[model samples]
Target: MLKHTGRRQQILVALVAFLVSALATVLASTVTTASPSVQPGSDGKSGSPGATSTKPSAPSSLSDPRKPLPIGLAYGDTLTWKNDQELAVGLGDAVDSGAKWIRVDLSWNDIQPDSPKTYEWQRFDRVLNGARARGLEVLATIGYTPKWARKAGCSTDDACPPADPAKFAAFARDAAKRYASQGVHMWEVWNEPNIPFWAPKPDPAGYTELLTATSKALRQADPQAYVLMGGLAAVGTDPSIAYVSQGDFLTAVCKLGGNKVVDAISYHPYTYPYLPSAKTSFGTAMEDISSAQGNLVSILAGNGTPDLPIWITETGAPTNGPGTATDGKTIPPDTTHVTEAYQAAIATDTVQAAAANPHVGAVFWFSDQDTGQAADKQHRSMFYGLRHFDGTPKPALAALKAAILAYEHSR
Candidate 1:
């Protein structure tokens, strides 16, 4: 998922220029696949020892009677690599756009590169502190195995799960204790574990173990913290590869008792090319997340927890990027790439659809801004941001803001 380019250097120059202009005016701000798994391992029956049996339950609404449904933005690794000033601007834009929450990765490998004994908090400190300064809540996604903690023979890949779940739990516990008071209360256990890229091979029992350990540790450190299962990548079944469908993965995890430890199930239902409401030809109606939500609910209920909520942690359509259009048009000339107008329309529709669903608690757009220069980046996925990489607003940004405001007002 890492791309090398001079884009960061370019962004740095743009930020510097913007900062100078703001100083003149006294300030300113700016902003996985799976296969028909050999099924997720179920330890025989539900509620069995080490298996989750507690019925899934939603957080009590009375707990925060006045809190509004959250609209968040996935800020990616920006905080981990960007400077303080860059972060401040990005966060400020999020606040301005009515984003109630911002998700950032808290990579274990980055924080404890050498050994568990040596922890580096400088980068995360700046991100948490910067977000707090902007009056924004943070959803810290904790994951990635350090080289020392990875299983034997595994490359130094962050996606590899640690050989010892307790070590991962210990890191999570430390993070929870360190950031509980910093206005970072929500924690997502990992990122797209359903995909092979995120996990060497998708294993229900293994992910469940990681989730259980991390959840328990975080709870012990901060009882009030909300722990969410990492968002599953939305894709259909394909037997040839080692990927599992989101539905099957959810079923296996629940059967293995994942529901007992998690507060909510998270997913990234990116329906690119097709609108969120469009039905996919792939037998399953997952292209429309609302349909997927129904499937998720049924799966959870059957596994024992029927009352859990779904958090759409990431989803978006890129307006312009390196990709062919569904209509078979080449993207760059404005003939093939998804039009800005279409992106805005779909964004608005997607948010509205999520808001209408009672099961959905939060909807976080894939990003607040696009990555790299739109013209130079080879990966179209990097263009999913609501704003262009250089900080210019896209129509989707306005659409998102409006959707958030409308949803809040209606509530």
Candidate 2:
């Protein structure tokens, strides 16, 4: 009887243990079934197959090619009585009227009054700081020699300078460093160095030397800023006296040690008494100036500097200057013939043409004021301004405003 009872108890205990083990296994399985494992997507880059993306999309505005046109105005004390106050006022007006940049003439003479010793920086600092305060970008052109620094043959009659490559380079380096500290960028080594008006004589070697020295020194001063070569005045009529036919000058420039020192080729493709149209106007055609610029582009493209751009530093028609100056040098009679309306029309055409050129990064009108020189009397003397000396709007001023409006609308 005792053996039978003991066996029965052991069997019952085993059954209970088996039932508990089965329940625990069922609970473990339920826990695992509640959680899911991550699966790879079709692309293998996403959470699951055909999963909706949560990544941010690119902004719509940045995806377009069209951008705001860079409009610049030529402002210098030589033309207008420019002081810090006047600069502020002019800059304010420029910003109001759609000018993105201000071309300031940093005459080598102005910054360095003497040779090799000291630099007069007060005026430059004033101009730079004033412009900055007013929110204006500067396209600074450094050229012209002071009476003391002029080479032996350089005439005091005008602003021309003899080629003293070393001295000029030193000035450039110092000026660039001083201004760079002020956050000023964008420099044009010398103004129209290929022309006799700016140079003592037409010598490509001399110009190249000046360019190389100044460029290297400028870069040393500020590696981040840009250095633009001065514009080649169009060889309008008499290509001989025009200071190394525009094309030849450009070719010479390119052949000289390549464009490692230069960034952009500055040009003055002036349209004196011409307007933009499908057909070439009387004195204007892309082909006319293409001889110079085309060769430059080709050379740059041939080299690896295909991305280099161009800037029309100065462009427009002068109603008064001699129509025969092939070098496109303007002998200002003190004013210009472009009436307010006429000037406005030309201004509009200029902006439009500049905008159309993909390689043209910027264009500055030749001048801002009539230069208050009443002694000289010619259309060049009387007209150049978008306003009169008293600050009244001219038709050309209106035209510029309209063009800017049109540009804004197109964008």
Candidate 3:
């Protein structure tokens, strides 16, 4: 969620350590940033560079893989500028890969850049059109305040919260009305409100205030639609960072009755190096989202929102980053580096873990394709994609498809 802002300084510092490894040699000899086995298409077709053309085979009719537990994906901003053909291939891949849902941004800043009276829906309309044609469900994330709406004296960043909650609610109501015909009902309020994405500083009470108004507006626009609080981050406490941890932030929100405002809870459990299915007493976020005593699971139950569902809106690991001479086998504190095989295992295990947990409703991988080689905030984020930047499918893609199929058939 804070992808554009390199504000996770503590996490970024640990991510910088990701580099080439004498240790990675033990994991797999041919493993590197560029996987040798990466091919052009998921369906055996050849696509030229930049993923311009690689027709994924039509999704199999054998059985609906999305029946029991489905996987969803966010393509980052790759589809924002792609042509219709390229957009079809990306969405097509999601269908062929067993994804039932597709997450999209309905940014307030983008749709209403000037006066609040004027609105633009064409850009998002194009994406939603493609998603519906592919039979994919939409989770529209609503946030990124326009400059006019930002509180006075705040930095000129889009992450700033609006000066008034009612104004923000009006925007949400309009977005929901405009898209109700297109079958977009699920809404995720803001992205990463527990961090700098909320701007200046994160405030649980303030976010609860915003959610109360926004959720009401969404349901009013379409009575059937559900609202999800923005996906809280998945990292533990670090003395270096000024942001509140997801656990503490959720506690404050629940204390203020936030759980009663939103229809469900959204969380991002981005576990790398270690898998989400692991059971241990370690301080990883898996405990915070799942088994730990004071975790969010218990938080909701104690707060009187016992039946509320948990949506894993985002989670995934990167296969490679800036290669370092340090031993990658030992694993650094915040690095996202893992081999392609390991990443594939993450795809499979993430589904398995969610399927085993009754509280988790859906799982969407953070990205659909690798973005680029350049690092953001010293973290090589490009490699998190299940496919290469050139539109070639990675091993993780097939792993995700198989996991979804397994889950469906078992049910």
**RMSD per prediction, one decimal?**
21.7, 15.9, 23.3
Cα deviation in Å at residue 360, candidate 1? 0.6
Compute the lDDT of residue 292 as modeled in candidate 3: 78
lDDT of 1 by residue, 318-339 (tens): 6664453543122234332466
| Candidate 3 lDDT tens digits, 306-396 | 5566778888887765332122245666564777787888889888887777677678887787777544524556778888777788899
Predicted candidate 2 versus true structure: per-residue lDDT over 119-149, tens digit per residue = 6777677777767776777778887777777
Of models 1 and 3, which has the larger lDDT? Answer: 3
* Residue-level error in angstroms, candidate 2, position 50: 52
For model 3, the superposed segments whose C-alpha errors exceed 4 Å read 1-67, 76-78, 238-240, 322-334, 374-378
Model 1 CA lDDT for position 381: 69
Task: Point out the higher-scoring one by TM-score: 2 or 3.
Answer: 3
